[model samples]
Structure formats: structure tokens, C-alpha cells
Target: MPIRTTETTVTLDHPFALTSFDSVLPAGVYRLEIDEEEISGLSFSAYRRISARLHTPAIGVLSSIREALPIDTRELEEVLKADRTPIILPAGE
Candidate 1:
């Protein structure tokens, strides 16, 4: 039973919320950690994602307590995609 962990930083320009979090997270860099397990009985090495963790309070925010909140990969992807997509302002302001 071999397990692998990958870490990456994700930046969000706008505040967002995740199901795992109690409140909306401020816009900033967040640490994302993904854990996977190697699939057995395969000629080629393959890994399946087991869990994902998102660091709270962003990377630069000052807080007494920091927590790694569990998150779903799919939901995280959706939030990232939404963050990347520009908001369309129709008509006159």
C-alpha cells in the first residue's frame, strides 16, 4: 500500500466558499495538498486520488490558528475555474 502526496499553491482573486469551510475564504494564495494511492495489478504505475486538503486563511493572512480543511477535488476545480473566468458586466453601470 503505497501512498503519494502532492502539494501546490492556488491563487484566487475573489473570495470564495467551500463546503468544508464554515465561512467564505478571502481571496489569496491557498495551499492545496492531494493524497493518492498506487493502484495494484497494473503494469504501469497509476495513482488514484484519495483525499484533498485546502489550507485555510490563505497563505499571507495572519491568524492565530491555521487549519487544513478537507475539500473535494471536483469542487475545488470548479471554484478555480470560476475564479479564472472574468465576470461579465452587461449594460451600463
Candidate 2:
């Protein structure tokens, strides 16, 4: 089961790339368009991604790492900021 699915679409000033635990999204902004769950004492989730050819395209699907990971969680809205910091999930989760 999934707790929820989240999507945050934002315009990038330049080409952007976001790398998550199991997925990577290459530079693209959706001008015309855009775009999880749990277990035991721990939570595990799976997600299916959709992409827009005209606007933003999904680079890959992502799954939360279940073992030896810190589970770095950030808002998509935050990552797409002008700072352009890379998203890194710590191990030992």
C-alpha cells in the first residue's frame, strides 16, 4: 500500500537535474504542462512516474530504499529552488 503520491511542478531558470535514491530526472521545465507508502516499524513505498513530452519529462521511477539508508526526504518544491542543490539520501536507513 501507498501512503500518498506527491507532485510539484516548477519552472527552472536553466536545465535542471534531480537525483533521488533510485531515480534521476534530467533538466526540463513544464511550461505547457508538468508533474508513495509503508511497512512494520519501517515504511516502504513504490511509485509510478508519468512524463510530458511537450513540457516536463520524468527521468525515472523511484523507490524508497529499505535498508541502510537515512531516507533523505525533501519537498520537490524546495529542490527546484534557485540554489539548485542536489538531493542526496543518506545510507543506513
Candidate 3:
């Protein structure tokens, strides 16, 4: 018999911290939950792969911010929630 599958995909205009999904998921192996999850035994492999690619750029921006200005996490969070895409840059240039 063939296995039945269901898939969900959410593409954000801006990248979100992995924590964003915490509210929706319980700690378990979830497959077929995301379109990327369909890629074999590693259910979240695709998401991880994509995140790795984005990490470098994101980190560069974060580092730049730390160098240039005093950052407030609460204020940043409020701004981020309002904007679909917020710029994150490393402290220097």
C-alpha cells in the first residue's frame, strides 16, 4: 500500500528566527508537515539547509549592528513585528 502524505509550506518575505515556529510545533519528528520535509528521511533537512545559507548574511548584519549602535531587543522586536522586512546589518560597514 502507498503511504498517504500531507504537506504545508510557508514562505516568508523575510527570514524568521527558528523560534518563530515554536508555538506551532511540539517536540517531535514531524514529516510531511512542510513541503521541504518531503526530502527523504531527514524531515527538516531542507529547512536546515536553507537556514544555513541564510545564516551567514544574517550574522554579518547582526554583527555590524553590534559594532555601530546600541541595540535594544524589545524595541527591535516591536519594529520587526510591524515590518515585513527589517534590515539587520553588522556593527561596522
Candidate 4:
């Protein structure tokens, strides 16, 4: 399927999950890049692929603070997958 990119904002009142992502998104606004596609066959054909990245937290002393924020527990497979970067602070910040 061919994919096109579209920009949208996700606002969560509670933790939310994405098919490809393991993390539960916290309550907040998240900027996302959505991919859309269309297919044709005997019946209906439509599919989409989307990808979004969150910034990693700091190490050592600041680690615990980062943990409180909503995100996946595992490490990112590809560290430098994109040119753009996201910045997330501690829960209170």
C-alpha cells in the first residue's frame, strides 16, 4: 500500500495505546504524523501505516523523574530514526 503523511494532534484523557507502540500515552497533547493508504480488490481495501517518536529521558539521577511520564518500558530499536526530535519533561514540569 502507498502511504501519505498527514499531521494531527492526539489529546488523551487517559492512557492510550497504538497498534505499533507498546507504551500507553499519558493525558496530554501529542503531535503525530499519520500515514494513509487505499487499496482495491474484490471487496473494500484500505490500510494505513503510521509512526511517531518520543524523546528519550536522561540517565542516572534524572531517570526516576522521567519514569513517571507515560511511555513504553522498552528502549527504542532505532535511536536515530528521524531528523525531528521530541522533548518531554518530568511529570511536574
User: Can you tell me which runs of candidate 4 are displaced by over 4 Å?
Assistant: 17-23, 38-93
Give the range where candidate 1 is weakest over 10 consecutive residues by summed lDDT: 54-63
Model 4, span 1-93: residue lDDT tens = 667766655444444454444555444555444455755463866764444344323222233434322223232223222212456798998
Off by over 4 Å in 3: 1-67, 85-93
lDDT of 1 by residue, 4-71 (tens): 99999999999999899888989999999999999999999999999999988788789999999899
Candidate 2 structure quality by residue, lDDT tens digits, 1-93: 434434444455455434433444445443322224433354654443332222234223234522221222343445566437665789975
Give all TM-scores, in the order shown.
Answer: 0.95, 0.26, 0.20, 0.33
Q: For candidate 3, lDDT tens digit of each residue in 14-87?
A: 43343323222222211112111224566553322111111122221333322212223344355347455567
C-alpha lDDT score of every prediction, in listed order: 0.93, 0.40, 0.31, 0.43
Which residue pairs in candidate 3 have backbone atoms (N, alpha carbon, C) closer than 3 angstroms, thus clashing?
A: 61-89, 61-90, 63-90, 63-91, 64-90, 64-91, 65-90, 65-91, 67-91
Clash tally, candidates in order: 0, 6, 9, 0
Task: List clashing residue pairs in candidate 4.
Answer: none
Distance from true position, residue 49, model 2, in Å? 17
Candidate 4's TM-score: 0.33
lDDT of 2: 0.40
lDDT of 1 at 76: 90
Model 3 residue 47 lDDT? 29
